[model samples]
Target chain A: MFWRKLLNIDSKIIYVVVGLALLLPVIKPVGMPVSISEEYTRRFYNYLTDIPKDAVVFFDLSFRETGEAELGSSVLPAFELLQKRGVKIVCGGQWQQAPFFMQSRLEKKAEEIGSVYGVDWVNIGYKPGGTATWRAMMEDFWKGAAGVDCNETKFDELPLMDRVRKLDKETFAAIVIWQAGTPGSGTWMQYAPDIPLLAVYMGGIGGNARYLRSGQVQAMIGGMQQAAEFEIITDCLGDATGLLDAQSLAVLVVIAFIVLGNISWIMVKRQDSLERSS
Target chain B: MNMDPLIMLEAVGTIAVLSYVWKENAAYRFFEFTAIGLVAAHSIVQTWNNYLKPTVRDRMIGDGEWYLLIPAAIGLLYYTRVMDKKFSWLARYPISISIGYSIGYSLAYSPRPFLKEFRNNFASFGHVNDYIFLLVWLLVVFYFIFTLMKKTKKTLRVTGAITRCLIMIYMGVLFGTSILGKFSRLLGRYQFLLRDWLRLI
Candidate 1:
């Protein structure tokens, strides 16, 4: 009876417990020890840090508002890191909201450093075409970007644009994609495989072990776990690091629920068998 | 209390969506509908601003590239699907064009990357882990063989069973990671609610 009662508890109770698990860490400061996973995040961190100054890094912002939670945490730090390195970033995306999301972070970081927009960085906004657009960008950057900035400012006017006229391996030192869905790093890898392509994938889509092994993706930062590692390496404690405690608690709660349910199920099955035998 | 109406709205929406975890109710449905409506409006505006405006202003009128109108006309035929059954076939032209282009483009580029990846898998046999990977990869591939006739080898059957077990383990790990990913997003929302909205943190 106890086993059945335990198994039959209202789902609402579980929901409230999970909600508390997520909420408690935010309300209280518990500095959870975050472990560094070197496989992907370290590689990504090294590539970002080691890139020479005045080198062009193409940041493809491919996430929308919904993805802001996960991708934005890593993105802000990435911009900060790039600014520290004094890298000239050519920001573009396939998603329409990407420019606004990406530019806001870059501008915030640039402001702290007193970096001029047109000189230090340029955002061409979202090019409408997907794969075809990537191919065009590879062929000719100005043409692919439609020769206009996110604000409809001509590319010729931007100082950074003077250097980034095309999208070849030589023209750009590296490309990093903060990606969620299609027209993302996958599209970039297919169109511009020769270039050193790195990606920060949403943890849900971070299942491509083969790509990492093959070096198709030069490096990758996947999910918040990896994002926390990147933050540690950069020595910048940001949102990803702050949220790590909550992530750990939430996972623990879910696992506890799974274990409890399984144990109850087994107990109930055993009771039923004993009763039948009697 | 948060003075920002936007933050207040966001908190309300978050709570409403999260309400589904407790029980499906009108509050959850209201927010869900609002989200869908907002996304629909956003898509329309973006498509107009990002795609239609540029193609018309820059390519067609600005450059006097009248030839751009041809594809535009073809693209317009896609709307015919909503109009009539007979005209629905007109949409097929654009669809076919897109599919054909994708297939051709993928065929041209995808094989080289795949082949390169496959070659690397074979080349990296120096480590003990490399042999395990190769074995798992082959077994998983064998598991996908749908043409297993009655006369199939016993070894193949045994490999298929082992592959299924391996796949289940792999899937479990993937599932765990995905849950962590989703929970990270949830944590982000909670952070916003507590720190930005309620200012509790």
Candidate 2:
């Protein structure tokens, strides 16, 4: 009976419980300690911190709107670190929707820092041709970037672009990729294999592991756990840390449900077996 | 209580989308359709502006790169698929070209990076962690070997069993991490609902 009750509970009830678990924390903050288990996040943080000012870095903001909640939180703090260091960034998007996210972040933080467009930073916007686009960018940077910045300004007009003509180790200091899926870090890895690449993956550790195993990605932050870790480590309080409470509460609720279900199932099975044997 | 129209729409959409967790209905369907339509429209506009405008339209006329027309012609051949049977084969030309290009590109580039990593796996085991990692990696690789004969040796069988167990453990860890990832994403939607739209937090 207990097993049946546990298994057949109304789905709506579960939804309401999970919803509240997420909601209550956001409304009233509980200062839950966020643990930093991933060593790579600290490595990534340190790597980004040590990069000299005026060192041009190509950042691929390839996360679309759907990934904003998870990946965006991590990027905001990382972008702040980059801005704080005065590291010149060449932002580009492999995904079409990525530009809006990148633009909004800059409008908020970069503008406050008095960072100038085209001089201090430039956005090449969406590059359509996946691997071929990266290869082409390597072949001829301006041609591959379509010879214009994200604003449709000619590369020749941008002061930063005057020094950088192609994608190579000598031209750029490093590549930081904030990616959700393919045509992102993978494309960058395949084309620009030699460049020191840092990737923040908002996905499964399985995929992230492969890139790490292959040494294709020099550093990585794979999930919001690491994102929260990065925010705490950087001392920049942002969305990822804010949402960690809800995330942990929801996860605990689900785990509790799972454990209860398993216990009830085991008790019911034992009762049935004893009855049959008797 | 947000009075902004954009916030209002977002709040409504978020609730509508989340409503599917209980049960699907008209509100969910309406929002879903609207989202799909918006995304399709956005993609179309972006593709035309970011891709087609510069590559096809501008390059042809403004740059005098008339030679780019060859690939454009090959691309047009893909439209032959919806045409009559005689023209359908024309589609294969572009498909084959793309496939060949992809294969050659992968062959020329992919191996070195992976091999570079594979070489690192063989470096001197300086630490206990390194040895354990190498052993687990080898066992996981062994789990995939499908050539075991019906009369395989007892040691091989035991090794295979151990390999399978290790792989299962690896998979379980990865699955657990994936659940955590999804939970974070779910929390993101809630953050938007409370912080951005409702302004309650």
Query: Model 1: how many Å of interface RMSD?
Result: 2.4
lDDT of 1 by residue, A129-243 (tens): 6778778877878877777888889888897898876788898888889876666777766677888988887764346766777778888877777777777888777787777
DockQ of 2: 0.54
Model 2, A57-165: lDDT tens digits are 9888887776787778777677778877888888887887777756877667777777788888888888776777777788889877787876778888999988678
Runs in model 1 lying further than 4 Å from the true structure: A204-206, B84-89, B146-158
lDDT of the structure predicted as candidate 1: 0.80
Looking at the true structure's interface, with contacts defined as alpha carbon pairs within 8 Å between chains A and B, what fraction does model 2 recover?
0.48
RMSD of each: 2.5, 2.4
Query: RMSD in angstroms, candidate 1?
Result: 2.5
Which pairs of residues collide in candidate 1?
none
